[model samples]
Target: MATPYPTPISLSKTCIGWTDIGLMGSPMASHLLSVGHSFSIYARDPSKALQLQSKGVCLINSQQDLAKISDIFFTIISGPPDVCSIILGPQGVLSSLNPGGVIVDMTRNHPALAREIFKPARKKDSWSIDAPVSSIDVGAREGRLAILAGGDIIQWLSPLFRIMGKHMYVGEAGCGQSCKIGNQIVGSANPLGLSEALTFAERAGLDLKKVLEGIRRGSAGNMIMELFGPGGFAESLVKDLGMGLDLLESEEERAVALPGASLCKQLLCGMIANGDEKLGLQGLVTVIERINDIQK
Candidate 1:
């Protein structure tokens, strides 16, 4: 019973509020501020958002306060539980959403949770969109994230989307989450394959740097290799892959198979076992190294 939200007049007229002032959210909010939008923001740690506060963005104390002032509320918090609590709890944003207000959740979320959020938002005569984004540290700072949005309101939201990153409206409220998870599943193959290839070259006494540089020019060249060539922390990958596997397990009747994703998960689990969970996707190389008994 979700309904389409009416589009607002213009960026200047649309009041924006957001939560999560962490690494990714900070730069994103900054972009919105850069455009001179009337913006308000909330953060558990007010100190984290002081820089933005000094830029004339209102620093509100709670989501409830945000809902009261904002026409479009955005959130990109830690997990589904926090997302639910922030939007559904007593003092949550949706509790006080103005008529026709919209909530855009940018967290990588479970599709089910995303759909559930749409219902209440609609009940309030507002709307919700699951718009999970992906970017590395540099891309985020540069506003080059890939935003996969799920909602009927894409056209209405495009102006805002353009400020954050490249965006595509995939489908209804939960579809963005599904697509993000699927992307994670497919992307896992890159790091896993890279790890295996590097491990093989090292065992053969080849120069690791030479092999990496050579791959950079061939059909094997990819953004993953470019981003994680020397190895970067992929702790978030653990969460992303786990979410995909959970979705698959929940939908066993679909009979879909992703053997590569399963293998990658196993390897990540091995990395976790060795207390190297803090390492990046490149750390998979270390896991491969351990498997082959390759010495330092």
Candidate 2:
């Protein structure tokens, strides 16, 4: 049996804050509320956050206000640029963040960016953690996300982490992001492999669903098929692949060769360039079938 995690720390005295409530963030915030962790939030479009408001989560008017009242702030924004602008920009979190407060960034951001943000936050006697989450919106809603966190505040935030998902402390400030990049590399590559196999199977006149079921019972089965099948739209995977490409660009400076990830990136870019970016990982089959001159 797996070891049971320690009891969660009471968050009654800690004022939590969540911003950028998109698909993933909304469910995550709701999970916290369900566990009785009262927190505040700031939404760019107030209407998107009305459901949260109805749950009695205090809605603040600005990032500064959100920062002022929060002892532990969470940001689940888009990417590096948004993370930088929201935390370092004028009237951003740093402007009014209390000394010794912790900022948990759950964005799938670049590790270097996470390190950069850590510097300034540290200078002001605050802390930052790169705790990018794993799992889709559905997983977030079910509180089954595997949260990879890197920073000094893991001990203090363990209780809250428990409420969200199975949490792992990867390492220092940017390690969580580094792990996320690695995750994307595998995640993107897996779909491509599945696409090729499925295409080959379909061309051989095999039942795709039956093949998936049999494969799932073996090591060949994976989350990609479980969540997206062969033609569903995987918005998160597309975004993660884009972020992986950015990481590769940075790695090139160090003479790192990620040929596999690079190839997957090219394939995904082709899908996007062809206006099929909205299609999920399974959609890669469309591109593969086209390349092989086979009809889906």
Candidate 3:
């Protein structure tokens, strides 16, 4: 039986499904609510959705319920599996979303998966935009995230994008994920370099803070060092490195060589293995410290 899709609504008046209430998702959703957009949220823990609820957002019980009335559903879950299951599994978005609805996946997912989901969504008269976001939780909180969007609706969605941050329309369906992969590759690698430098400086008995200050004013200055240099989030490195590895694995057929990304992956894996996965990206200094000890 052909699934019945709801009539398309104007973007400004569209009901939205703001799924996934993680570190980044929470703030992103809050920004939408602040702008007076109607929202339907499905969170595992209702407590987390309380704040949004108080602000007139509806708390729903199931993904299907959220999809039923929403003209646009936004998902910013963790990994590819989570994204796939939410959109493709039984009673998932594809099974319930109205025909003219739009599904925007802002998760850092595999490009191939984005492309795969695009096909079925189109058949349902729905559109999918793989618009994985860049920037950390801080950026999301401040409504300054850099969004790389893929799909044909960039012009139509520009206003919504502006509510969160600046957006770049990359290309057709999966290009956003492709761009995100490129982003993770560079993003994951920078911290490792910073980790090495910081570890080396600390071992050399230099003032690490002063070292950062000195280098930040020189050619070595970068966002990674400035934002996550000494007292910044380090656990994000583990997540981003893992995502980078997953992106590389997805592109294995191409035989791309990414030694630095691989090395960062191993280091982050080592951190998880060492039970330091909970630490922020700056915790990579611990991994570097351990490696230096072994080398000594």
Candidate 4:
């Protein structure tokens, strides 16, 4: 056999890409590479490019270069500012595109801005699609990503997207963003509850293991406990069973995790506020420590 990877498929793809590759994007790109999509990357930090380099991935010098070469450009950046600059700024991809090129912004951006990206791209015979994606590192590498797409271009890219995510078509322009934000609210449920549930145990002087057992293997059991739990819950658990991060990772949809989801934030805030702010965000343990100190 010649090779299973980089096989010449019926589709020809060239992508100018930017990704916040700390976790999800790594596996996503690996899958893209396996399918033989030529890519060019332009991240704010060049050091982030090394991992892709190790995988024999091609590096594109700038967003402009990306626009000049690729017919379909994609981005998975962290925030809106990053999204805007890559597509709209002077050094951005928009300034240097050939007619008929399209931008597939996988990052969930503000619905309003998503519309804005479409306006200019279309004027030049190009297009932009707000197809926000949701999946963790494991799913991306496995080509089992779940995407919430907005706009007609989805039909055009559906075949390519199948290589990245499971289909979750919501609707056009900003509807996918709406769904992605909603998904994050659901994703936050477990972590927020864990903070409160764990704090209560430590304050009561209950054995953490026993407390975990009491709640788990029962109705109180949740996805977070199942994955992050101590008894045989090692790194492989996350590796084996994938986590759905929601489209909340991208800029447009990041606040989607925020809007209309006050319960999780409120609970976490209460847990954190009962303790000193001096300890900072990951210091939920301080709340229990302080309450116990007072009781003693």
Model 3: C-alpha RMSD to truth? 3.6
Each prediction's TM-score versus the true structure: 0.93, 0.90, 0.89, 0.70
Q: How does candidate 1 fare on TM-score? A: 0.93
Greater lDDT among 2 and 3 belongs to 2
lDDT of 2 by residue, 94-164 (tens): 87887877789999887888888899998988888899997777778888988999988698688788888
Instruction: Note the Cα lDDT for every prediction shown.
Output: 0.83, 0.80, 0.79, 0.62
Model 2 misplaced regions, further than 4 Å: 1-9, 230-239, 248-253
Taking the candidates one at a time, how many backbone clashes does each contain?
3, 3, 8, 7
Full candidate order by TM-score, most accurate first: 1, 2, 3, 4
At residue 43, give the lDDT of candidate 1. Answer: 98
Q: By summed lDDT, which 10 consecutive residues of candidate 1 come out lowest?
A: 1-10
Clashing pairs in 4: 108-252, 108-253, 109-252, 110-252, 145-165, 145-166, 151-172
* Decoy 3 TM-score against native: 0.89
Tens digits of per-residue lDDT for model 3, 178-243: 788778767667777888988888778999889989989998888877667332234555555555
- Pairs in clash, predicted candidate 2: 232-280, 233-280, 234-280
**What are the per-model C-alpha RMSD values against the true structure?**
2.9, 4.8, 3.6, 8.0
Candidate 3: segments with Cα more than 4 A from true spot: 1-12, 229-253, 294-296
Residue pair clashes in candidate 1: 232-280, 233-280, 234-280
